[model samples]
Target: MRDQEPAPFDAERRLSTREAAELLGVKPETVYAYVSRGQLTSRRVSGGRGSTFDAGEVEALARRNRRDGSGGSGGGNAGGELSVRTRLTLIESDRYFFRGVDAVDLATRHTYEEVAEWLWTGRMVPGITFTAPPGSVSVARRAVEALPEHTAPADLLRVATVAAATADPLRFDLSEDAVLGTARTLIPTLVAALPPRGHDRRDEGPLAHRLWPRLSMRKDPDEASLRALDAALALLVDHDLAASTLAVRVAASARAHPYAAVSAGLGVIEGPLHGAASGLAHRLLQDVLEQGDAAPVIADELRAGRRVPGLGHRLYPGEDPRARALFALLERIPRAESALLAARDIVETTARHAPLHANVDLALAVLTVSCGMAPTAGETIFAVARTAGWIAHALEEYGERPLRMRPSGLYAGPRPPQPLPE
Candidate 1:
């Protein structure tokens, strides 16, 4: 008998069109279009006429397209745009959705500690606990103690981070888990060190609950109010590689330690063009309330060619998701009738005058005032909440290979030959 024919190798084991599209981060239609255009080659099965492309071929096409600035993982290149690269940790999707649940929903149903835990570690359960590495606790404690008496909690945190970084032997460790653990411990410790502002210290719960005494004039926030604030922080915690996050990663790219990286981020955030807009928005609302109408005020400002702050963003075309969420929470407050009216009038007036829509800064400003926090503390609160994201980005940057960020510039100056009179 003739030897049995050797079993034929299976070629269809390679990626299907759908799998190829998923791996390339493009739509299936795009993959099919590529095959149709001969940009990628496909083979038909012996019995069936349908085509299947080799996975290696698809990957090679992606690499070649990326090199030629044609197309790659993300999408089409009709605009001839190079894909913007970033080494920062992105929380857009994962932080937005956890355990198949929305972060906004979890924020409403859970405490700030639980949310922090979920962000720092990927778990939704309560067994996770934060502890500073052996010597880190002592260093952090000493740093906190060394802060000038009566310093605001947020400022104290700034000072303590610098000191803790100086004290830590492992401060150079840029591992994700290490940095997140450090943040978990650092945030709670800094909160605990804040000077008592009022009489709310008797409340029992997480550091955020205890922090109320140091940040609010009200001795006790009603349960509803506390929940709202908690949700607000959760919503504001992170966005994808924001400007401040970019600053942190840039600093880390220079090999700065975590504290220095965060400090750089804070400096960027303190600018009026960034985090301070929220405080400005609150003041603007106050002015509108005092003046009894916003339409004329807004019209006058626009007529004078002055732009109102906290009304717009480069992202979020429709309206800010965080702003909408916070506004919904603010509407629940019992005595916010005047503020609500002012907010409505401002929104209408602003829309009529410009394309800008209300962003999170505007809503956060209103909420800060409603919470009885001092006007200056509004920006400080934003810094505190965003530090988690900054540190995460810094750590991610530290792990990536360093690349100098210098860009070429045009020589616009005229050549100088003759010397000026001495």
Candidate 2:
């Protein structure tokens, strides 16, 4: 749990507004409001990229809010009972399901776009393809290109989504048909928005083929590698109310459009403990391969007091089903042999101490490393694939009563009549 949160702060420590928001259980805008009210002091980074707040001051303000009886995003109701009803996906034992069918089966047996389309409409359309409009692609690419070169892949996707939304006059239409239309077009737009690597860019094929160029620049993937990537996308399309999916559901509950709902989800996916995990795992695997052993690499990580990435999941004690599904596919890719062995070495080395099993992030790292994709490629794939799931959840939330997800916060502060601070 400590690893899931921002690092602990000292008096002089600085935090980005996003970091401040996570600490205070509020949005970044609320963090700025604290600055405006003189409750916190903020400074602009030297390059004028963004503002940073004093960590100690932010901590003090958080304490004050708790003392004043104001609840925050992390709090639950007094009874502590919280659960949301959903028909999209279910997880029990070690396996998961989508719409009453085995998710692993769907991922292995169908194309990614086919799985995504079925998740939205509850019916399969064989040989289905989603294409982005030229106008949407144009605007989205311009917006993405305007960002700093160091912008994360997920951040690029977020910017493209907002820009694409601006071009759609019917963005607010919550009708099933319209949202479905948004789903089909918006996904391809996201894939197309990213700068392509290979010269063989085409908008006409399986989505995995289109996405391949964005993640890997030099190498055109083999047939087996392409299949593995497709399966990976389908396997990750949705999980039961992941943090990002919950954000999407909440935004949908507020009547935000599908694009906005997905944007909200994209916002949550970049957190260290979430979408970035695969990137970390990818780097870790690179180190292991370079070092010629996982033992020392794992030792150094443990010595640094860092939890090993790509090992163990809170939701699964024995094995992660997604990892199992992906690893099986990776075995068929001959080029993945070395990375696969490294992954096995990692799991076996770590298990001697903590009994941790490999999770999907490790499997994803194997694919990326083998295919010569960047460290961030796994996250980009995750963001692209999960967009389908976010839209499905947004569509689901649009059906129920609005604001149904507003969980009550348990106040832990003094009585309201307390004297004002001097």
Candidate 3:
């Protein structure tokens, strides 16, 4: 049996570094460099025999290098996921941080304004305030009111964002100072533009207080409820590279105006699988509230091959810290005990059946229920709070390579004829 031509670069086989280097006409060290730069992915051999690369990916990189004239050296991988660096937020050890401050601590101690400042400017500037100009508020309000009667609150927010942008003649300023200034006013403006809940009070507290009447049915929400809403906003200020954050960054990377970036974020967040998860969790909590038993509900959700909304986060191995913090605060509220108990029941039931733990969505859901807010209140809260994060991300992305998020497709269609007759 002749030594049949050593199986020419088997695309199905995972290649060793040396094998990949040989096929790509590069050194083994260069192969390792590609892995480090995220141009290629590597996995350890089962028995710890160094590392291996995906053969198809390696070939793709080689072809891309040849076409681009860069020889697989710099820039992002052609057919690989891009991992952009950001200093805004970090998720480590199941805890989220903005800059260096823990989010849970911020939720408890700092106001939403302070947290937003930290995320926006990397400094915890105290006494910073955000107030939408009365004229801008009027414009946004008119935009919000013009929507169809059944428009969701989140959609109203999106329209308000665009309206505010249109009203501000200076919205094109991309400088950090200008963007931060716009955001400071933009958030409060959006809050004020929400359909008023008919609660007119002289004492205007934090943004949460200003926002409470809009989110809840109560004419005057208690201090504890206001605090919970504030914490929800602060806790959601920023999370590293969420889908919506990525959308904001992508828009910013293309030099879209700040409002456009924010609108992109809102649009992505409107998806049921993202920021709207809390609304589903709200419904689930409603069931728990009415039935007073979570075991059967949990069983039904799992039986239908459905995940319990607001339970389990891929990033947090243990309980979500934000959920824990909010639950603690909610448990302290006088009338929130029943909602808290329902939350606990759902959590316990979820844990026994699966490793699913309560996440931020559940926290928001229970908080809304406790405070007697509407079913869509959690989503409204998420969208508004997450605006701060989206702005922060937009600012960050503005400083990076423009339009770096453009992706390539791996064509899997049938090949065309090489030479067609005219």
- Give each prediction's root-mean-square deviation over alpha carbons: 11.2, 14.8, 9.7
Candidate lDDT (C-alpha), each: 0.66, 0.88, 0.83
Candidate 3 lDDT, tens digit per residue, 1-422?
87767756667789888888765655577788888889999999998879999999999887876555344232243344345577888899999888888889977898999899888887877867787888898899899989997798778999999999989999999998899888989999888888865655322558888888787777766778788888889998888888998888889989998899999989888777888899989999999889989988878888999888988888899999989998888876898888888988998887775777899899899898888788888889888999999998888877765665554455668688657768
Q: For each predicted model, how many residue pairs clash, with residues at least 3 apart or on different chains? A: 0, 0, 0
Model 1: residues >4 Å from true position, as ranges? 1-103, 127-156, 199-204, 303-305, 404-422
Candidate 1 TM-score, C-alpha based = 0.69
- The Cα RMSD of model 1 versus the native structure comes to 11.2
- Per-residue lDDT of 218 in model 3: 72
Q: List the candidates' TM-scores in order.
A: 0.69, 0.81, 0.81
Error of 3 at 36 (Å): 10
TM-score of 3: 0.81
